[model samples]
Target: MTEERGDVQELSDFELAVYEAVAEIDKAGGAADIGTLTAQIDRPEEEIWAALSHLVSANHLHSTADGYTLGPHDWAP
Candidate 1:
Protein backbone atom coordinates (compact mmCIF):
# COMPACT_ATOMS: atom_id res chain seq x y z
CA MET A 1 0.00 0.00 0.00
CA THR A 2 2.83 2.36 -0.64
CA GLU A 3 1.61 5.84 -1.47
CA GLU A 4 2.81 7.78 -4.45
CA ARG A 5 5.25 10.62 -3.91
CA GLY A 6 2.63 12.85 -5.47
CA ASP A 7 0.20 11.87 -2.75
CA VAL A 8 2.69 12.90 -0.08
CA GLN A 9 3.29 16.16 -1.89
CA GLU A 10 -0.42 16.89 -1.92
CA LEU A 11 -0.73 17.19 1.84
CA SER A 12 -1.53 20.57 3.36
CA ASP A 13 0.76 22.16 5.94
CA PHE A 14 -1.41 21.19 8.87
CA GLU A 15 -1.76 17.68 7.61
CA LEU A 16 1.99 17.38 7.32
CA ALA A 17 2.39 18.67 10.83
CA VAL A 18 -0.02 16.05 12.11
CA TYR A 19 1.81 13.38 10.19
CA GLU A 20 5.15 14.47 11.59
CA ALA A 21 3.74 14.50 15.07
CA VAL A 22 2.55 10.94 14.61
CA ALA A 23 5.98 9.97 13.38
CA GLU A 24 7.48 11.46 16.49
CA ILE A 25 5.11 9.38 18.55
CA ASP A 26 6.38 6.30 16.80
CA LYS A 27 9.95 7.32 17.51
CA ALA A 28 9.16 7.86 21.15
CA GLY A 29 7.44 4.51 21.46
CA GLY A 30 4.20 6.17 22.40
CA ALA A 31 0.68 5.96 21.09
CA ALA A 32 -0.53 8.62 18.69
CA ASP A 33 -3.59 9.42 20.74
CA ILE A 34 -5.36 12.76 20.67
CA GLY A 35 -3.99 13.75 24.05
CA THR A 36 -0.40 12.86 23.13
CA LEU A 37 -0.62 14.57 19.77
CA THR A 38 -2.18 17.66 21.31
CA ALA A 39 0.68 17.83 23.78
CA GLN A 40 3.35 17.19 21.18
CA ILE A 41 1.99 19.59 18.60
CA ASP A 42 0.91 23.16 19.29
CA ARG A 43 -2.51 22.97 17.69
CA PRO A 44 -6.03 23.06 19.04
CA GLU A 45 -7.86 19.83 19.66
CA GLU A 46 -10.39 20.68 16.94
CA GLU A 47 -7.64 21.34 14.45
CA ILE A 48 -5.84 18.14 15.40
CA TRP A 49 -9.04 16.21 15.05
CA ALA A 50 -9.61 17.69 11.62
CA ALA A 51 -6.09 16.84 10.50
CA LEU A 52 -6.35 13.34 11.95
CA SER A 53 -9.63 12.79 10.14
CA HIS A 54 -8.13 13.96 6.91
CA LEU A 55 -5.04 11.79 7.37
CA VAL A 56 -7.17 8.75 8.00
CA SER A 57 -9.35 9.50 5.01
CA ALA A 58 -6.29 9.81 2.83
CA ASN A 59 -4.85 6.53 4.07
CA HIS A 60 -1.89 8.30 5.63
CA LEU A 61 -2.79 7.06 9.06
CA HIS A 62 -4.64 4.17 10.61
CA SER A 63 -6.60 4.01 13.81
CA THR A 64 -6.59 1.16 16.27
CA ALA A 65 -7.69 0.55 19.86
CA ASP A 66 -4.20 1.55 20.96
CA GLY A 67 -4.18 4.74 18.86
CA TYR A 68 -3.32 6.08 15.44
CA THR A 69 -0.22 4.97 13.55
CA LEU A 70 1.18 5.33 10.09
CA GLY A 71 -0.85 3.48 7.48
CA PRO A 72 0.68 0.94 5.11
CA HIS A 73 0.92 3.68 2.53
CA ASP A 74 2.69 6.07 4.85
CA TRP A 75 6.21 4.80 4.83
CA ALA A 76 8.75 7.59 4.69
CA PRO A 77 10.46 8.43 1.50
Candidate 2:
Protein backbone atom coordinates (compact mmCIF):
# COMPACT_ATOMS: atom_id res chain seq x y z
CA MET A 1 0.00 0.00 0.00
CA THR A 2 0.99 3.66 -0.35
CA GLU A 3 0.56 6.67 1.87
CA GLU A 4 -0.16 10.02 0.25
CA ARG A 5 0.72 13.31 1.83
CA GLY A 6 1.95 16.71 0.71
CA ASP A 7 4.48 15.92 -2.03
CA VAL A 8 4.84 12.37 -0.71
CA GLN A 9 3.53 9.85 -3.17
CA GLU A 10 4.72 6.92 -1.10
CA LEU A 11 6.56 6.39 2.15
CA SER A 12 9.80 4.46 2.30
CA ASP A 13 10.19 1.57 4.72
CA PHE A 14 12.48 3.67 6.87
CA GLU A 15 9.93 6.47 6.99
CA LEU A 16 7.22 4.02 7.99
CA ALA A 17 9.48 2.66 10.69
CA VAL A 18 9.90 6.15 12.05
CA TYR A 19 6.14 6.64 12.03
CA GLU A 20 5.51 3.38 13.89
CA ALA A 21 8.20 4.18 16.41
CA VAL A 22 6.50 7.47 17.15
CA ALA A 23 3.18 5.71 17.48
CA GLU A 24 4.67 3.19 19.91
CA ILE A 25 6.20 5.90 22.02
CA ASP A 26 3.05 8.01 21.98
CA LYS A 27 1.02 4.99 23.09
CA ALA A 28 3.39 4.64 26.03
CA GLY A 29 2.45 8.17 27.10
CA GLY A 30 5.87 9.64 26.36
CA ALA A 31 7.10 11.86 23.60
CA ALA A 32 8.93 10.11 20.74
CA ASP A 33 12.32 11.62 21.37
CA ILE A 34 15.23 11.20 19.00
CA GLY A 35 17.34 9.58 21.68
CA THR A 36 14.62 7.04 22.33
CA LEU A 37 13.98 6.41 18.65
CA THR A 38 17.68 5.83 18.03
CA ALA A 39 17.36 2.78 20.23
CA GLN A 40 14.18 1.42 18.67
CA ILE A 41 14.81 1.97 14.94
CA ASP A 42 17.50 -0.20 13.35
CA ARG A 43 19.05 2.54 11.23
CA PRO A 44 21.72 5.17 11.48
CA GLU A 45 20.83 8.00 13.82
CA GLU A 46 21.00 10.48 10.96
CA GLU A 47 18.64 8.44 8.82
CA ILE A 48 16.09 8.18 11.61
CA TRP A 49 16.23 11.90 12.23
CA ALA A 50 15.87 12.58 8.54
CA ALA A 51 12.85 10.31 8.37
CA LEU A 52 11.26 12.16 11.22
CA SER A 53 11.75 15.48 9.48
CA HIS A 54 10.32 14.14 6.26
CA LEU A 55 7.28 12.60 7.92
CA VAL A 56 6.55 15.76 9.85
CA SER A 57 6.85 17.82 6.69
CA ALA A 58 4.50 15.45 4.90
CA ASN A 59 2.05 15.75 7.81
CA HIS A 60 2.41 12.01 8.34
CA LEU A 61 3.63 12.79 11.82
CA HIS A 62 3.52 15.71 14.25
CA SER A 63 6.14 17.13 16.57
CA THR A 64 6.86 19.84 19.10
CA ALA A 65 9.66 20.66 21.50
CA ASP A 66 8.36 17.80 23.61
CA GLY A 67 8.87 15.35 20.71
CA TYR A 68 6.92 13.41 18.11
CA THR A 69 3.42 12.00 17.77
CA LEU A 70 1.21 10.40 15.16
CA GLY A 71 -0.57 12.80 12.81
CA PRO A 72 -4.16 13.61 13.62
CA HIS A 73 -5.14 13.23 9.98
CA ASP A 74 -6.20 9.77 8.91
CA TRP A 75 -3.01 7.99 7.85
CA ALA A 76 -4.33 4.62 6.77
CA PRO A 77 -6.70 3.71 3.96
Candidate 3:
Protein backbone atom coordinates (compact mmCIF):
# COMPACT_ATOMS: atom_id res chain seq x y z
CA MET A 1 0.00 0.00 0.00
CA THR A 2 1.05 3.56 -0.60
CA GLU A 3 0.69 6.46 1.76
CA GLU A 4 0.25 10.04 0.65
CA ARG A 5 1.24 12.91 2.91
CA GLY A 6 -0.09 15.70 0.68
CA ASP A 7 3.25 17.28 -0.18
CA VAL A 8 5.60 14.74 1.32
CA GLN A 9 5.32 11.14 0.21
CA GLU A 10 7.30 9.43 2.93
CA LEU A 11 7.33 9.14 6.67
CA SER A 12 8.36 12.01 8.89
CA ASP A 13 11.32 11.96 11.26
CA PHE A 14 9.42 10.33 14.08
CA GLU A 15 7.81 7.80 11.80
CA LEU A 16 11.14 7.04 10.17
CA ALA A 17 12.71 6.47 13.54
CA VAL A 18 9.90 4.20 14.59
CA TYR A 19 10.11 2.30 11.33
CA GLU A 20 13.86 2.02 11.73
CA ALA A 21 13.46 0.65 15.22
CA VAL A 22 11.05 -1.91 13.90
CA ALA A 23 13.43 -2.82 11.12
CA GLU A 24 16.24 -3.19 13.61
CA ILE A 25 14.12 -5.50 15.65
CA ASP A 26 13.54 -7.53 12.51
CA LYS A 27 17.27 -7.57 11.72
CA ALA A 28 18.13 -8.67 15.23
CA GLY A 29 15.62 -11.49 15.03
CA GLY A 30 14.24 -10.49 18.41
CA ALA A 31 11.47 -8.64 20.11
CA ALA A 32 11.93 -5.27 21.77
CA ASP A 33 10.15 -3.89 24.77
CA ILE A 34 8.88 -0.38 25.27
CA GLY A 35 11.98 0.47 27.30
CA THR A 36 14.34 -0.61 24.56
CA LEU A 37 12.37 1.17 21.85
CA THR A 38 12.30 4.33 23.92
CA ALA A 39 16.07 4.15 24.40
CA GLN A 40 16.52 3.65 20.68
CA ILE A 41 14.42 6.66 19.77
CA ASP A 42 15.35 8.72 22.82
CA ARG A 43 11.66 9.19 23.43
CA PRO A 44 9.36 8.48 26.34
CA GLU A 45 7.66 5.15 26.89
CA GLU A 46 4.30 6.61 26.02
CA GLU A 47 5.65 7.97 22.74
CA ILE A 48 7.23 4.71 21.73
CA TRP A 49 4.12 2.85 22.68
CA ALA A 50 2.09 5.24 20.55
CA ALA A 51 4.35 4.57 17.58
CA LEU A 52 4.10 0.85 18.17
CA SER A 53 0.36 1.20 18.35
CA HIS A 54 0.36 3.02 15.03
CA LEU A 55 2.40 0.25 13.50
CA VAL A 56 0.03 -2.28 14.92
CA SER A 57 -2.94 -0.38 13.60
CA ALA A 58 -1.32 -0.19 10.21
CA ASN A 59 -0.88 -3.97 10.16
CA HIS A 60 2.87 -3.52 10.22
CA LEU A 61 3.31 -5.09 13.63
CA HIS A 62 1.90 -8.00 15.52
CA SER A 63 1.53 -8.05 19.29
CA THR A 64 1.68 -11.54 20.68
CA ALA A 65 1.64 -12.84 24.20
CA ASP A 66 5.40 -12.76 24.22
CA GLY A 67 5.97 -9.36 22.57
CA TYR A 68 5.83 -7.51 19.24
CA THR A 69 7.30 -8.66 15.95
CA LEU A 70 6.93 -7.74 12.32
CA GLY A 71 3.48 -8.50 11.00
CA PRO A 72 2.88 -10.86 8.11
CA HIS A 73 2.75 -8.08 5.53
CA ASP A 74 5.58 -6.03 6.94
CA TRP A 75 8.26 -8.18 5.34
CA ALA A 76 6.95 -7.65 1.86
CA PRO A 77 9.01 -5.37 -0.25
Best by TM-score: 1
Model 2 residue 31 lDDT score: 81
Please provide, for model 1 over 1-77, each residue's C-alpha lDDT reduced to its tens digit, 9 standing for 90 to 100.
44533377778998999998897786676659998888888878999999888888888888888889877643453
TM-score of each: 0.79, 0.78, 0.68
Clashes of each: 0, 0, 0
Model 3 per-residue lDDT at 65:
62
1-77: candidate 2 lDDT, tens digit per residue = 54556644578887877887898788777789888899887789999988988898888788888999877555442
Mark the 10 consecutive residues where model 1 has the least summed lDDT. Answer: 1-10
Q: Comparing candidate 1 with candidate 3, which one achieves the higher TM-score?
A: 1
Query: Order of candidates by lDDT, top first?
Result: 1, 2, 3
Model 2 scores a TM of 0.78
Please give the lDDT score at residue 44 for candidate 1. 88
